[model samples]
Target chain A: MKITCPSFKYWYPRLKSGKLAANDEQLAINHLSTCEKCRKAANAIEALIEDKIQPESDVFFSARLFARLEKSKPSHSVFIFRPVFAYTLLLSLSLFLGIRLGTYFYYQSSIPSENISISEEYAIHSTISGLDVFFQDDFNE
Target chain B: MDENEKFLDKLQSGDQQAFRILVEKYQPMIQAIGIQMFERSEDNEDFIQEVFIKIYHALPNFRRKSSLSTWIYRVALNHALNLNRKNKWKKWLMNGLNLIGSNEQAVPQMPGQIEENAEQREMRRLLNKAIQRLPENQRIAFVMTRIDGLSYAEVAEVMGISEAAVDSLTQRARQNLRKHLSTYYKSL
Candidate 1:
């Protein structure tokens, strides 16, 4: 049904098999009437498609697939990818890590910087301010 | 999202009902590919089931950036080709072991084949042999474009090749098959 010669030639099997509907099939036949190249290509591969379509598989085919699914469905994937379980796991993990990190950091900071003695803070600030003044004086000089 | 995207979410999460739907939808396509790709096998149904099982396991790993059916085709074709290659190696090893003659191919006598007349059977056997002898790329191109009823563009998408490349490959595949059949007729 494609416009190109390649497409036409490739579609020969479908045409020969009459799987194409009447209208489309007629159109293909019309085109093939004038197209010796397509006809030649079709004649070459006629043997391949001449075989009857492999019979419709027995009705139990889907049943067998489902039966196999019951036996072969890997459980861990179902459990792990279960939407509710996955979301709950992620949420719980984040909460657990958040609480643990918050507590650990709080404990590590028992001597919080805000708790520095006023006198020590004043001394640290004075030293920093003095260094800034020194750097300014050097730049100016 | 589209129907397939929604269905894909379920498939990726290992939803059984969704998997069943997928099996129903794709088994026919895979079956067609199997018929076109190799000689009839006793385990043809099993091969399709194996493809489904592989698709199930591989869903998580499959990226959805492109069309899912294209990916499925690629998976089906790749699996079929790999199985064919392995079978060839096995057949060769059997031959090497002096278990079978060179001309004595493993022309499987499946149920459908049982009904074929001798002339039809001979034609099928010759076609199968010639197709199997085609270079891998040509064989894939031939199966997809010629037998599977996929357009060259569709095959290109599945194969990750340019449409021009697909066209060339298909032309070459047809030419090679023509040569193969011609040689046989010439022998007669």
Candidate 2:
């Protein structure tokens, strides 16, 4: 239906598209009345558009859909077993233990260093010095 | 509350009856979309179910920004587009299977009304396949505007595109359909 008529070509696309402007509508309708080719073309286009084959949903579609939807919702057991919840619990447990162990180790490391009195320090040095002297004397002998 | 607002309230409150009513209301529209947007073999209760399932989940987030049906169409159109993109491979697979063996079932010639309905369904299936060959936007625009008989503005609203854009799409669609459909349209 590619008529060389400028107006036909101009309006054909719009006519087929169902978007012909108000002004062009009357012109198209009048042209369509006179031009058998464009009319046949229009009829063919209409048939193609109107060849409706809408498939209906089966009777049980809703039942299957709702069943699937019910399955998709999280259950209490599923919530407890979720990876995020499991990982968070593990991380919290690890963090608590890490803090407690870190504190214990920190205190253990610092206790003697901070709490040793001058006398205790002197005693330790003197003990080391005596051992050094004893070893030195034994080596000399 | 108005009908939609009240319906939205029931939906948000997890009312099963409200959901059922909604699904029943929109089944035909979604089915019409599925027929055009999906392959004959690809469209099933599951496809519609997937769409309605999406709608079900998203209902909680519905802002009433547009009418629920408009929003549902938007969602369905998006889903169909996405699935069709992914289904390019499925088409090839189906074609391969078809080549291996066409498993068309023989229909018994029943009485008048049943046989007529079957004939109608067969015609629709072939037409759907023809429409499926169209590019995504063109196919949707063509279906929404022509087959669905939606106004260009209404289609624009559903597609979230401009009316001018819808016009261009539909024009191209009509031209393309006219070209391809020249023989088949006459035969049908």
Candidate 3:
């Protein structure tokens, strides 16, 4: 019963799955007994397949988790600075500032030039009337 | 409503007690994952807490597409993998430093007990390292199926892969582990 490495490989899955025929399983057992390398490989594979060490949780695990959860809970104010609110605030402020600037510019551009010239004429006329009063007083004296 | 749905509803409605119940129910599963995934024992508690915290935040958005257990498995596995990736480099450096500074002779042990225990620990550590070295999907598949005792169908559901895919991944993972362990034992 000469079992090649490839033959062992073929039988290995069946051996692990317990699906190998009784004679084939005996043959594999014989081969493993004679071959130290194959036996070591089999042991290593078994160890790998074995259940891993289960970690034990502390008795207060739930309490600890709750504590941590409480500590990490997001405050209500966190919503105020959320990206959605921040973006909305920025857009509204920009729109308001844009409208205000636009209105100011429109008013500046819409006022007639004649209004400015008429205001200047009123100031000169008032000054001339004051000068006439001074001349009339001098003539009466 | 099912127990999970009721629990989820309470959680979404700001029921702290319900959230605690949820954490209590899943703590062992999360701890199991953390123990397998993390090298440090102390990190398991923190890792489990993080998983539950994530579940808490994500619970409201959880549609009942999968069972709560399956969803929790997915979250735990994903979080563990992410944490494993993020901490890999740091863990390696710390391990290296420990190896350099370690004094094996300082600890007192029984005449034969020390050698046996050391060998066992070494083998376990090597096995863990091999599993960690595997690709993410394969590692998850292997851990879920072998370590966590999940059936292929359950693993497939949690991983969102086909049952056949789970079978293939587990097979490949086993082969890879065998190769790694054989090489490592030969070197030893």
Candidate 4:
């Protein structure tokens, strides 16, 4: 069976702090005694952990941090409904309706009046001049 | 109210004090990761400021899809990474030039900067440089664990991946770092 490369996983914390469990300490020491590669790897990781350093504090920025926090205050409205966008929409809608109505009225107004003229069966007054001719003869008789 | 909800409420109401509190809590963590990922010569302060600006504008629209910290960290990380990646080529060219000028002058080193001592500083710088050289995912995984001290679960939650993925990423990160550090220390 191939001895898989020791995952070296368990060694990280041990290597970092230079402390080891009673059982693992001997094993790590034994392995390092013969394996130069593993030894160097262990020392490097140890150095890294031992070298832990804190970053510099930005006092001025931090002092201003609270003041800066004020700047991040979320606005009440998620979406800013701009007056320009609203007015543009209103104008577009009005223009569209006006154009539609104007087109309809203009088409209607452009039609010739003769196309819808009223037809009369006869000239009523001209025909009615002697409307009682038969009735008057009957009364005299 | 939960801290996050309260913070959301304050933000919605336009309370600047609340915003400042949030930045103070998170900026150090963000700055650490930003430095790990980017060059010291870059405008990291501006980048940090922009992250806050985004959080400010985006807070109103923030849905509770993730925990507030995770969401904030995601935004911060993405912004930092994007900025770093954008300047990568410029950094590479400058790095070449700096390497050539390495012998020109006794570089003015800060006096008290040696507080950590020579060995510790070298190790940290080496570790930082190694992490920075990693692929983006590996680098974030390394920094999130080693520097930020986030738990594997927290890292997983922040990355929106399974715990198993976080484990794998972290393992890979450590494996890579171990290899790089070995090479780095060999020359010393």
- Cα lDDT computed for each candidate against the true fold: 0.70, 0.68, 0.71, 0.64
**Colliding residue pairs in candidate 2:** none
Listed models, DockQ each: 0.08, 0.16, 0.15, 0.08
Q: Looking at model 3 chain A, which ten-residue stretch has the lowest summed lDDT? A: A119-128
State the lDDT at B137 in candidate 4. Answer: 85
lDDT tens digits by residue: candidate 1, B78-105: 8888888888898789888988755744
Angstrom error at residue B62, model 1: 2.2
Better DockQ candidate (3, 4): 3
Per-residue lDDT tens digits for candidate 4, residues A1-141, read 111125354554454335567666666667777777667667767556333324444656655544555676655653425666678888999999999899778756765555543221122222245545554444446
lDDT for B21 in candidate 3 is 77
Question: Order of all candidates by lDDT, from best down to worst?
Answer: 3, 1, 2, 4
Model 1 quality (TM-score): 0.60
Error of 3 at B29 (Å): 1.1
Instruction: Write candidate 2's Cα lDDT for B15-61 as tens digits.
Output: 99999998887887776676567654445456678898888888889
Judged by DockQ cut-offs, is candidate 2 incorrect, acceptable, medium or high?
Answer: incorrect
- What are the TM-scores, per candidate, against the unseen true structure? 0.60, 0.58, 0.63, 0.58
Model 1's CAPRI class is: incorrect
lDDT of 4 at A78: 30
Per-prediction interface RMSD? 7.6, 6.5, 6.5, 6.3
Top lDDT: which candidate number?
3
